[model samples]
Target chain A: MKTVDARGFSCPEPVLRTRNALKTLPAGEELEVLVETVTSRENVRRFALTQKCEVSFDETEDGFRLIIRKP
Target chain B: MSDRFTRFFASRWGIVLTGAVIGLLASLLQKAGNPPNMGICVACFERDIAGALGLHRAAVVQYIRPEIIAFVLGSTLAALFFREFKPRAGSAPIVRFILGVFAMIGALAFLGCPWRALLRLAGGDLNAIVGLAGLVIGITIGVWFLKQGYTLGRSYPVPASVGWIMPVLMVGLLLLLLFQPQFSEGGAIFFSESGPGSLHAAVWISLGAGLIIGFLAQRTRFCTMGSIRDVILMGDTHLISGVGALVVIAFIVNLIFGQVHFGFAAQPVAHSNHLWNFLGMVLAGLAFALAGGCPGRQLFLSGEGDGDSAVFVLGMITGAAFSHNFSLAGSPDKLVDGALVVGGISTYGQAAVILGILVCLVLGFTLRERFE
Candidate 1:
């Protein structure tokens, strides 16, 4: 699993980072994104889902950890 | 308490309320003595602040507007209270800065930013329709760029103190506003004796309004550019609904205050040049989209410790100086022998707009993740 720690960043940044990281991910590989804001979480999830990646998340103490599997 | 408050603001109605409040306050500010149809213009206010600081010699628009100073301070306070202040930087800072410069140039060419464009419409300036259309078209182009994996790279976290820079500078501006210190009578700082810079709401009232709006906006993440971008990219109307509320409520308030004068000619602080109005906002919209926020949103971001946004704001101030010094800003129409001579950008201003568009296109195309 590859981790893109987007903690403490705002919108577009997190989503953009997630997209960039997903570009190099091979099929069936998993990527995790750590974000500290609900806005970033939703945005990253939406972007991932649009790209046909399977997405799910777990709420952490401060924010959320999104797990994405590239198809 | 804070959790419930945050959740509420995240709800749809909360966002609408935020927009409505902003609309109400903006109209009231105009009625209270701010420039006509310009109660709260981030771009214009920043321009005035730039002139006040002697960044430009435009005497008619020089004042340390308290509202602008309070915006950064208010947002910083709100971010601190909410524990949302996260200082970060290093994401193609130069690109963002250049985008900001072009954004201001484009805005001055139209004599307004996105907020002022909407305000102009609400106050019955028919010229704003063209500007709004241009903004939409520009955002659509940016959306295309985003669809093609456009990115400005990623920002890394920095020390918390780094985030306080903008807030401290804002505080310094507040001090200047309070003291009005002079370095040999208009040699250092400048203030407008007449014109839009001289017209303003009371300082305390303006400060209060700025602080309130900044706080609410920070909490809700309100952004005009984001509203358009989200609608185009995600089919989301959450932010646009807020924008709609702002326009609707402002219109109603303007109607009640007798500020509605429907016309394209002789509108205060506005020109009647349809083509430049459209093209100017087109440049501004594209720059805002590329930079990831509108002027107001950038200020809020700076308040919350985004160094990249701070740099963008500085670029905007500098751009204002450039616009005035180089005669790239638009002029209001004037009555000549009972005929309205349509005002617009100068030849140099037109060229600047074209150059700005080309620069934005180049930046958008060259900064993509993959060139396939």
Candidate 2:
């Protein structure tokens, strides 16, 4: 499991960064991405599902952490 | 609060400047060729499109506007470059559609949306004052709902393909306009032979202006309703200042260009119905509030790949069709199907605003702020 932090980025940056991170990981590896902004949070969740990855999101003090496991 | 808004605008001058430039260009479009009261009306253009599609038989207001196509395409590019394009849907879409319909209905009844209504007033059409008032009242009501706790629920994730649906449709329409088979005469498409429908800026000019404005507005988050709403709710005046600048600049330009024609006797395509103007905008204001953006904002949002806003934009187009088809739209000849439909829809729209406010109130009181 590797964590890719993207907490300060706005809008699609977080989602795009997460996608980029996910691309490097091998199959069955877990990638953790952190993002701020409600819209971005929702976008990442949706992006995860679209990529056929399993996702679980949890709220943190500063932002949100989306844990994605690529199948 | 004012400082925050000021900072927001200052930090995002590109957006605000783009909005003003779009406004100026739209005015230029009117100067180049468009109806008197409508230089760059989203509702009016959509109505024209509806008529062109044969959804309405209004011969006078049918034209395939290139500016609309430019708006979507420009926004598409911006979203793609910014990587902000994500197409998702199904968050109370039906409600959004309904709101769109009523918003158009109300705007037509008023003879303009918030933008056109303001432009009308600025152009010295005094009747617009009433409509402007109604818009404020309606928005105030919506803000009341916001204070209460009204929510439109949440939009879930959908495929990226969903976002491209509208852009694709726009492309198809453009292709149809360009590759019109000369052999097919009066098949179904309607083009205005005369009247407001016949008047238009050049296709390239319209589209170019739209694309520019779309890009700028997307960056700035400029919204007419949001300007007023922020002022009323939190004493924020950033967006409103921009709007004020727009009005002042437009008025100055109109006067200098000899476009200022005072008195309301026969103001270019606009009627003199006072009460309907007020009531119509009230309906529009509420709908805009509930839906979370004005027609222009919706366009920009759609450009940025918000599928929900795209649906609402379509709803407005469909509503325009219904308005003209059912004779619910106002015409200079008559008062838009008497008072029955106007009164009925106005009442329904107001009721929806109230319901939305009540729901918001309940939610506002009950839902604790997780951050707070």
Scored by lDDT, the top model is 1
**CA displacement after TM-score superposition, residue A4 of candidate 1 (Å):** 5.6
Q: Return the TM-score for candidate 1, rounded to 2 decimals.
A: 0.92
Colliding residue pairs in candidate 2: B145-B357, B148-B360, B148-B361, B149-B360, B149-B361, B149-B364, B150-B360
Q: What is the C-alpha DockQ of each candidate?
A: 0.25, 0.04
Model 2 chain A, TM-score vs. native: 0.92
Clashing pairs in 1: none
Question: lDDT tens digits, residues B176-268, model 1?
Answer: 888989978648578899999999999999999999999988888889999999888777777888899999999999999999999999999
Separate clash counts for every candidate: 0, 7
Query: Where does candidate 1 stray beyond 4 Å?
Result: A1-10, A16-31, A36-38, A45-63, A67-71
Whole-model lDDT values for every prediction: 0.89, 0.70
**For candidate 2, lDDT tens digit of each residue in B67-172?**
7777777777766765557665665677678778878887887667887876776678777788889899878877666555444544545577877887888887
Best by TM-score: 1
Which residue runs does candidate 2 get wrong by more than 4 Å? A1-71, B1-12, B181-184, B333-372
C-alpha lDDT of residue B136 in model 1: 94
For candidate 1, give the docking quality class from DockQ: acceptable
